[model samples]
Target: MATSTGRVTGTARDRAAGADGARGRGRPKKAGPVRRSMSQHWYAWAMVAPVVVVTAALIGWPLVRGVYLSLTDATEATMGRTIGVNVIPSTYGFTGLDNYVDILTSGLFWDKLIWTVVWTVACVGLHYGLGLGLALLLNRKMRLRSVYRLMLILPWAIPSFVAAFIWRYLYNSDYGVINAMLKAAGLGAVGWLDDPTTAKLAVIAVNVWVGVPFMMVAMLGGLQSIPGELYEAAEVDGATPWQRFRHITVPGLRIVSSTVVLLGTIWTFNMFPLIFLITGGGPGSSTEILVTYAYREAFTGIRNYSGSAAWGVIILLLLVVMALVYRRALRKQGEVW
Candidate 1:
């Protein structure tokens, strides 16, 4: 019986091997060319490729060209050609650091830089203070809350150029509403845009007014996301309103506050159209920010392309440094997660 069982097992194993060989012979040996049609995400790539190419052409080319043009004597008027000789000497050749040094050493540039810093700090500080205060007040359930929110956001919703233009008119010396109000109050009409100090202050005020709406909206969003239970816990701990705000609200909003501050700084630093359209960097260039200075260098003052490029490079470096600093500081505070 054992011999019979062994014979049967061997026969079954041989049959299995034979079946495997037969199956292998019946199937094709090679996988025919994959035959992958242009279907799965291939069409999406095809659609986006043109856009990617065009964007690269528009943005990348100009950035690369700007860097190259910075090194050469490229100007809008002249396409960077040597005036007399092909072999240019140091006097006529590429200035390695002169452009940068010129802007750096210029008293006007430093004065503008200092004013720019002061303007940015003041605007950002006021914007956050007023905006967050309003956000907190409006975050509570109140009558006409929606109306107030809409009214608050209207400043931001309006185009910045339009707002700037309106403010410019409002600050006009002769017929401005501001001057009229001052006269009505028995005070002398203030030349808001004529005097250097007044002009700078006026621009900063307009900036703060227009900028606070955005900060308010951002803070309102952040406030809504804070869990009410935290506030309840604070109340249970017998915390005062200020203490609750300091502990729960402020801590919850640290990340948002940092973001708003950084964005406000960048926007305030890059403020151009407002100052240009309103003051035109007049009143002795007191309100000229880096962007306005760069524009003047590029377009007005001898059309110094090298000077403009140097200014652009410096602004880029400053922004990069600020971004790095914010990242480092926020990360240390564990606010960047």
Candidate 2:
């Protein structure tokens, strides 16, 4: 009985080996390419998975929820019901494009939009000019250059809210140092925050002061990266300073300037702290930008959260359009290369 069992086991093993050899010789075993690829990249995917999950949880979910809320009639009264809290026992319903229509039809929205544009353009333009000018001046060999750069950078190093608070006092109507200085100069006290035009200008000036250091630092780095030989060659050719600057300096800094301007525009567009802290979007919303308007809608009286979310979507669309235009401009300039 034992001998018969051993023979049967040996025969089965030999048959299995013969079948495996036949399969290997027939057409070559197929490689599972997709499985192989996944195996190769499993480690990379593992490393990236956490970041992807976190971003989805933090940014993606909120964005999706905001869009949903915008489509619904989700005011302060209905928000609790929508969230399952049922604090006020209200019901919310889909409103489709009503929020957007209302915003578009409102004169206040147009006014804020115009001011937002003016604020962004003016602040970014001044920041670039002041920063580039300072960068060029500092790039020249000068005494106490390090000290001067440090002093210029101090404004950027300070917290923006703190800077806003300090500026608020300076712009005070009565005994503010700025008014005192004007009085000393035989000029009347200017209503910095009180008047509409002056309030807008005052906030812009404060933003410019806070933002210039960043631009200056960026421009300085770009200036340093420029090859000295180019300047030397221009000098040897008897090129005037203005000619050299127009031809060489501006062209050399094109990429840097574009990047700085793009970032500065976005920052200035979304700037909330300075205006909120100093002006409170007050004196009848004179200095209110889109961001401030959205905040007021979401958090202040009435709490029109869905309306605010709609505004946020509009802001996002505007930013997307700006980014696309910038990218197209860069491509046209061959800067992307």
CA-lDDT, candidates in order: 0.86, 0.92
TM-score to true structure, per model: 0.81, 0.86
lDDT of 2 by residue, 218-255 (tens): 99999999999999999999999999889999998998
Give model 2's TM-score versus the native structure: 0.86
Q: How would you encode candidate 1's per-residue C-alpha lDDT over 1-337 as one tens digit per residue?
A: 9999999999999999999999999997663344343445577778999999999999888777565556655455554446666844333346577777777888877887888889889999999999999999999999999999999999888888998899999999999999999999999999999999899889988888899999999999999999999999889989999999999999988889998999998988998888998899988777888889889978984676766877887887888898899889888877754
Q: Of the candidates shown, which would achieve the greatest TM-score relative to the real structure?
A: 2
Off by over 4 Å in 1: 1-54, 80-93
- Residue 158 of candidate 1: its Cα lDDT? 86
Clashes of each: 0, 0
Clashing pairs in 1: none
The weakest ten consecutive residues by lDDT in model 2 span 79-88
Candidate maximizing lDDT = 2
